[model samples]
Target: MAGRTLIFTGPPGSGKGTQAAHMRDRLGFVPLSSGDTLRAEIKAGSDIGKQAAQYVQAGTLVPDDIITGVMLAAVSRQPTSAGVILDGFPRTVGQAEALDDGLAAAGRKVDAVIDFRIDDGLIVERIVNRRICKNCGATYNIRFCPPKVANVCDRCGGELMQRVDDREDVIRTRLATYREQTTPLIEFYDRRGLLRSVDASREAPAVESDVVALIEALG
Candidate 1:
């Protein structure tokens, strides 16, 4: 059977990435996070990653074409049977169009776009509390899921550090950029009747339940 493809979009710290992981664990879908994929490529030292690294090192965003190429390649690698949960991709209308073209060529398309709706102030707070394992990359929020020991990762016994982007000023800028860029993309999906939303202001489990119900309804 053909697999469904979903695009999860929202401001940073909305927990959409965590929900993507949850869906992958519970339903066997493959999660393709653009950030994770890029990081992996950079870690692997691939040519694409090399290109991406230049911009990353410069503290600028990776160009859309390069990101689109990596994301399309990522999509093509998975079997048509494993549903794809796309996280942190198609950040622009041009990239979204490219994704549409690429998927159309493969007889597939984005089945839905889940907008994780939350307030910007809440997102800033959430991100400010976020920390990640320096070794294993596990994420935690001090306000919610802090480790057993302060500044230590419970899973890997590694030190936990706050990412630079998790700062309040940077997060506010990112939220502003997200709102500006995602407005058109959200409208693009809405016009296609594939846009759905979950209240991310709620706890993660509650948001996930709504997503699961939406998925079942889609079936």
Candidate 2:
């Protein structure tokens, strides 16, 4: 079967990535998380990854050309695979248009666009207090899911550290950039009647319920 293509979009720290992860598991969707992809690229020291790292560290959007090329290549490879979920890709109208063109060429289209909505204030608090396990990539929040030991991962005894972008100042910058660059996507997809909103300020399970409801309705 030709799996579905889903675009998950929201401001930084709105738990959109988390929700995408949930849906990927529940629906057997292949997740193409752009942030994770780019981070891996950076780790490998690819040419484009080098370019992206500079912008990412500055809390700025990587230029549209670089981001679009990377995502398009990723999507092209998955045309015949399990359902693919786009997490944190196509943050601007230009990118969306490019995605549309690409999919049209492949006889595929976005099954739905999931828009996670939350206030900027909550986003700051959520991201700033978040920590990740350096070894296993397990995530936790100081306020919500504090670990058994501070600065330690409960699962693997890995050290927990704040992501550079997860710092307070960088989080605020990401939010501002998200509002400026990605917010219009809400209207962009809404005009096409493919946009669905999930209130992401709540806990992950509650948000996942609404998100699942939306995706299931697509059938």
The numbered model that scores best in lDDT is 1
Please give the lDDT score for candidate 1.
Answer: 0.89
Q: Give the TM-scores of the predictions, in the order they appear.
A: 0.84, 0.78
The superposed Cα distance between candidate 2 and the true structure at residue 67, in angstroms, equals 2.0
Per-candidate Cα lDDT values, in order, are: 0.89, 0.83
Q: Give the TM-score of candidate 1.
A: 0.84
lDDT of 2 by residue, 1-219 (tens): 567889988886788877778877898777889878777767877677788789989999688877876666667667565678899888889889988988877667888998888898988887888999999999999898999899999999999999898888888887888889876877899999998888888878999899888888888
lDDT of candidate 1 over 1-219, digit per residue (tens) = 679999999888899999999999888888899989988777777777788888899999799988987777778778888799889888889999999999987778999999999999998888899999999999999998889999999998999999998899998998898899999999999999999999999988999999888877889
- Clash pairs, candidate 2, are none
